[model samples]
Target: MIFMNMIFVDREKELQTLMQRLNSPTFELVIVYGRRRIGKTSLILRAISGRNDSVYYYATERNNLERFREVAQRKFPEVRYAREDWESLLHFLRDKVVIIDEFPYLIEEDKSILSTFQRIVDENRDSRTKLILLGSSISVMEDVLSYRSPLYGRRTASLKVGELKFRDLRHLGFSVEEAVKIYGFAGGVPMYLTRVTPPFLDWVNRELKRVDSFLRDEVDFLLRYEFREIGTYKEILRAISMGKNTLAEIRDYVKVGGEISSYIKKLERIELVTREVPVTESVRSKMGRYVIRDNFTNFWFRFVYPNLSLIEEGTYEITEGEYANYLGHVFERICREYVRDRYRVKKVGRQWWKDVEIDVMGLGNVKVAGECKWSEDVNPHSVLANLERKVERLGHTVDRYVVFARSFSTKEKMEKAELVDINDLNSWFMS
Candidate 1:
């Protein structure tokens, strides 16, 4: 019941594309899926805002198909024929727009629903119907609507929603520092952003106090709902959070004694984590490492989850004290992620050599390497020295060496190297 401003950012192009498809003559069937809280529903709602077309938006639950059909009937009253059966319901809807959220739940409740949908879509291929199925469970959505599934070739288009980019925060009225703090805590989830208030410290304090908060419970909920092997997933996340990057370290930490390839595959399927090999020509080498894909999950696993007992006991003071000690390092990491995201969006995909890893490296026609510092004062000499060492190790000259910091270096140092101040990060990212 909380009323907050709808801070919609980015996704403008996606919305326009969906609208264009909806207006086309062909019968459009789109599948939208993503991890929970990534704003699939929000994006769809925003696209349909102020539209006068016949639209029926139904959210599926764990109940039986009869109940779902009843709800669907309530939403779409134009069709005189109402039925509790799935095939009948699909057959009745024609020349209208239908959106079913959490589509996987409906498929799971009735296994034959996919085949029924395929038949209906085939029979009505000439009719003007725009149907969209949305789901938050990554695995279920992929398996059900993927090219290998029964409903494979039926979909006209598919979109996988993801987190808002750091560059989008400028539209939400957040300074670079504030955006970094929020992104580190919320991982660009729109729902999580609504829970955060101004005066960032206040939000942090409140978040640290709630034991049953979304931040505390999301990991378990996602694992239980999306993954079958919860124990293996937890072990892998714990290993990564504790700074175990290499596959060997993670396998040893899991203590499976043998290669944990199955567990790695499981984690990757759910998109909760990723395996990063050195950006090199050798793809078969076992030199890759695993890392958590989401920033908030990484922060939660590394800091908040480890101190659950303190959080539950209402020891806010103690938690805050400890957080203060490690906050600098956390912010430094966030800055690095921001710079890397900018590099990625700009089509810079280069990486440092295996022996020398820069905090952030942008590779395109021109190479850009960066060092992120979250200190009050940035020592330009130290950054330049590191860049020199990195260049020497790579045995190639980089096109640009940039330094990102809270505050710029002294006047003389600014003239020596490329410096991006914290305040200018938004512009830098947008560029």
Candidate 2:
């Protein structure tokens, strides 16, 4: 295990939130959940570090009741006799902070534990026991917190740990250009980020040659963890990654017989896929497009999955002819996420009407619409003119126009929009 001191990076807000709850006068039932490798365990461990009155229990599948009883008894030998029931066990654990890690495993073994836990929390509501339920499986954790579950509203606090933002990525000693390229493949997941060193493509090339590499199997692991039908989910995500954005497009491509709405919802709940509607469109808009939200997964389907034969042969001769234009979309996504994180906008998403699509639109006190150009020498005037026409096409007044590009030819062309180079990205991600 990594030392607690070395575990956290740019997680001040999350740490503060957890600490505040830790110091609360009332009992806390905090639920911390997220996708795998997103650092949910690290956050919990770091939050409760150095607390003498804390017990961290990891739940596993092998005869969970016996394991739970043994672990609880070992942790509190004073109450070994009370292990027959949860209420008494919790009574003995009063005034202590308890962490149940990978909690879904226990639930799967015996689901009646939910109601038992519910009863324990209710009976000991006025006590000083602090309970934290931590899980990495997003779907199972969500179901545990759903309205139909016995512990629906029992949680005092819930936190969904997300990937690191652009600012947070800087802590890994990556430059602006390096960060963008790295994020396109490794994403903001800390585990993925740590595995990727500088010269990102070189590392990926090396990893791809190895049959046992985690990079090659991450997608499969993630899918198999949540869904029983891995082939269908893979087909759905593969289609989305290849630019089949709409439901009709994905369905036609995959040729799945049944309705895929539930599968899409499952993916959405886990943060792997997202359904995006125009910023101005209502939530029920039929013009929504499904997108593969994870950068690593997107990269896998676009490059790795299709060329598995080449990878297996260890040729390392994959062509870059088709890669340039792909990064443009990824760069646009990185820009949108950066703006949303730094500006704290009410809404940040793509805007479209008929055939016209604006790369990013941020709505707040001042409406901001942006056009991204992944080119060596961008024609600023033409880009701005096109963006202006799209803004007009939307028939909505935009107060600010921003353009992101690799480089610009002349300053005269940028009179209409603010030109942001790919290297100078810190200002865009700053508060």
Candidate 3:
């Protein structure tokens, strides 16, 4: 029930693309689906806002066919409920924008509804109207609208919206450090961001108390709503969250034997997790590791779920004390993310070497490594020496070796190696 001003950003291009598609003379059909709370509905609303054409947005519910008929009758009063054919539904509208949100619910209630929609779209293919379908259930969306289904090739365009990027966190008033922490914990979901408020500790406290908080129950809801194999999905997520990143480790932890292979395929299809192979010469090695695709989920699994007993026992104060001991390491990881994001914005991709990983590498085709020291005193000499060894390990000569420190690096250190101070860091991200 927590609400705030609907801050819309970062989807201007998507909206423009949809607008252009809708303006075409030929009848258009678009399918949009994504993880829940990723803002599919918001995107559609913003895209069509202030348009001259009539737009009807309907959300299907978990109900019987009679209930759907009643709801449809109420929404489209001009269309007679007695007429059950697809043509009647098509004839009811003219030159309008038709949006069906949660269309899968209707399809689930009555499988015939898919054919009905297909028939209607076929009859109206030459018309000026546009039909846009939205669904949050990834499985249903893929099965019904994907190329393998009957509705394959029927959609004019399909857009799969993903979570916001860490670089985009600044729009929400988060400093580089705060941005990384928030990104690692809450992630880039708009709904999650809405819950962030002043006195950051208070916001975190409130979220911990709420049973319906997205952090606590989103995984459960997603599994229940989207997949039939809830037990298997839960086991897989639990294994990943518990740091079983390797495929063999996951299979061993889940103890699914023969079912483990199939479960992994299913999880990948829904985009809940991904497998990461080392960026090395051995591209075909089966040495890949699994990672939860969403940052928030990863953090929740790592920190929150592990300490649920403490939270439920009202011993969070003691638990927070334990958390404080490791806060430095956590903050250091956040600092690395800040540097990595800056590198990406600067178009410097990742590079790795055996047993040595640079925080920021391949900066503008030059090998660079950095250490983020949030403390007031950053040992420039140690960091510089580390970078020197890393470069040696990488076996590359670099134009510059840079160290990014939140505080000031000594003048002598700057003279020795390229140094970016806190002010420079701020400007780099701000620009």
Q: Give the worst 10-residue stretch by lDDT in candidate 1.
A: 1-10
Query: Which numbered prediction scores highest in TM-score against the true structure?
Result: 2
lDDT of 1 at 354: 57
Candidate 3, residues 39-120: lDDT per residue as tens digits? 8888888778787564444555655344534545665676564565545655666567777788888787777877777777
Q: Which digits, one per residue and each the tens of the lDDT, describe model 1 over residues 1-431?
A: 22123335667777887788788888988988888877788778877777655454555556645665665567676443756665576667776677788887787777887888888788778988888888888888888776778889888999988877656655556676776677666766677766777556677668778766776677887887686567777878889978898877888888975677777787788787777655443456576677787777777787667777877786743344454444454554555555555545343322555578766565566566667676657877787788768767877666777776777556354543577776666666555
Superposed model 2: Cα runs more than 4 Å off: 1-7, 84-88, 316-322, 337-345, 426-431
Q: Which candidate achieves the best lDDT against the true structure?
A: 2
Q: Spell out the clash pairs found in candidate 1.
A: none
Instruction: Give RMSD to native, each candidate.
Output: 3.2, 2.6, 3.8
lDDT of 2 at 21: 88
Model 2 pairs in collision: none
Q: Rate the local accuracy (lDDT) of all candidates.
A: 0.70, 0.81, 0.66
Rank by TM-score, highest first: 2, 1, 3
The residue-level lDDT of candidate 2 at 217 comes to 74
lDDT computed for candidate 2:
0.81
lDDT score at residue 262, model 3, on the 0-100 scale: 72
Candidate 2 lDDT tens digits, 159-199: 98888765666766677777777888867788888878777
TM values, all candidates: 0.88, 0.91, 0.83
Clashing residue pairs in candidate 3 (N, C-alpha, C atoms within 3 angstroms): none
Sequence-dependent TM-score of model 2: 0.91
